[model samples]
Target: MADNLTKYREKRDLKKTAVPSGGASVKSSNGRRFAIQKHDSTRLHYDLRLELDGVFKSCAATKGPSLDPQDKRLAVEVEDQPLDYGDFEGTIPKELYGGGTVLLWDRGYWEPELNKSPEQALAKATSSSLLEGTGCTVFVLVRMRGNEDEKRTNCS
Candidate 1:
């Protein structure tokens, strides 16, 4: 199932770029971790990454994440990234792939609010909220910018 990383690997030339060349041997952590990267590439955007099953599943939020529950952010799912990417902060050559500066915006961990397996809880949340009927529902509780306290937000 982890074969999903093909797109990510294909887009990056590990030898040409300073980006870490992650291998399958990277040990998976038991506890979940998440990070948001401030990517200044073709456009400026905040990339949210949630650690699940070793690789970090990704999403791109154009205007950054919000602390208010009333503010719904549109987080479009992207490809799974290498776990070590959570710590990456550097500049890709203008001619290279990403071709811009990458900053580690925020880092933290999260727990499922409904006390079930993450997948189950998410599925339950989506079904109960009817977000699944529209599209995939992604729930994350994290420390966004300027927020000392963590807030849970649903990204559908």
Candidate 2:
């Protein structure tokens, strides 16, 4: 039930910003895709996006991903960005909503370790290790709420 970038478009001025307006630039791969963007906004943080139903479910990882396995990171769920956002690497004007340097840290397809669809898994938030490998790197994304504490793991 993706909103097709309705909320994403509302916050951005398509005519003034360089961010990709939701279009047909969706990933052509067979598996679901994911992206990690290192954003230097008012503050620096990592944004993680998982593609499902043609839109990316986005979140801000406060401390980025952890490798200690014992550490739990805080990820705040944000708006759904267009799937094409996976390839975006640029600087949004300071006057823009997410004004900052956005670097495409990583991008690849992922496999879900769930019994249901990704959209359903996200809504249920029941998967401990939501996603498997992003190319060769393996990471975990525990379902997160708007401002809730979520755990992410990187074992690459």
Candidate 3:
């Protein structure tokens, strides 16, 4: 892996937690990807993972992803995870670090609009302290049930 998943590996014991101790990166025909997971730990939370630097940059949203434009959910940044962790879905034993079940909510590639390149967009966000959740307006779209429609939502 281009990024050392030290924290990711250090957090859990493979013998106890179902979470993987990831190593080495895989190349997919698909481009940069992202995954949203429903994590039932100490409290229920939705995790957002963006593929970057060969690792999954993570964030946690307690209220989950919003489908309304006016909603600005609180998202706090978390440690990076292994890219393979995107596929993880199972129960971590009660004695484990994150002791609970995990569900994969969504997984897909991201399409950036602001900068000429995806890298540039990431760079811009980082340089402006946006990646650190400073002056950052994160917009996410989720297709709600009943009607297939898109809505803009922000996270900080």
Candidate 4:
């Protein structure tokens, strides 16, 4: 049993890429860049990631936009996220580490209501909006405020 556990840990560790210091660095399929961070909330939450293509999009697990039992409450929004946000998994190492397991919940492309491609969505930014009828209840749109030429840094 101990050997199995050790091997499992080793494999998990190997799967972890070197996150950037300001945040967790992720490379999308098209070679685009993004970052992710997990919020240490009582109910457990993870921030979905994508680069500042102009803004940071996010979502969380909570009662959401409504409290009705029939109403699903996962919310997604756009907000300003630190570039170093990605390395948050073990931040609270002692309190919530071992008991929690990380998994990929879902992934796909999203289209904004404004006819903006994912790349153009960042320009005409406002607060993130929740998409109804979509699996998650709330969604937000955000825009990046600075020059997009910043170099990516290592997360160590």
lDDT of each: 0.66, 0.74, 0.66, 0.38
**Model 2 weakest lDDT span, ten residues long:** 147-156
After TM-score superposition, the amount by which residue 36's alpha carbon in candidate 4 deviates from its true location, in angstroms, is 9.8
- Against the correct fold, how does model 4 do in TM-score? 0.35
> lDDT tens digits, residues 26-110, model 3?
5673667777889999999998877777888777789876556698666666778888888899999877888889999777666
lDDT of 1 by residue, 1-156 (tens): 348678888899888887766664655555677778889988888887777666777877777755556776666667779888888899988788788999987776645555466555333434211111112233444322322353434344
Question: Each prediction's TM-score against the native?
Answer: 0.72, 0.82, 0.73, 0.35
| RMSD each, Å | 9.8, 4.6, 10.2, 12.1
Report the Cα lDDT for candidate 2: 0.74
List, residue by residue over 50-134, the lDDT tens digit for candidate 4.
4444333343443323334355443344344333433334433223322343333333334444655554653444423223322
Best by TM-score: 2
| TM-score of candidate 2 versus the correct structure, residues matched by position | 0.82
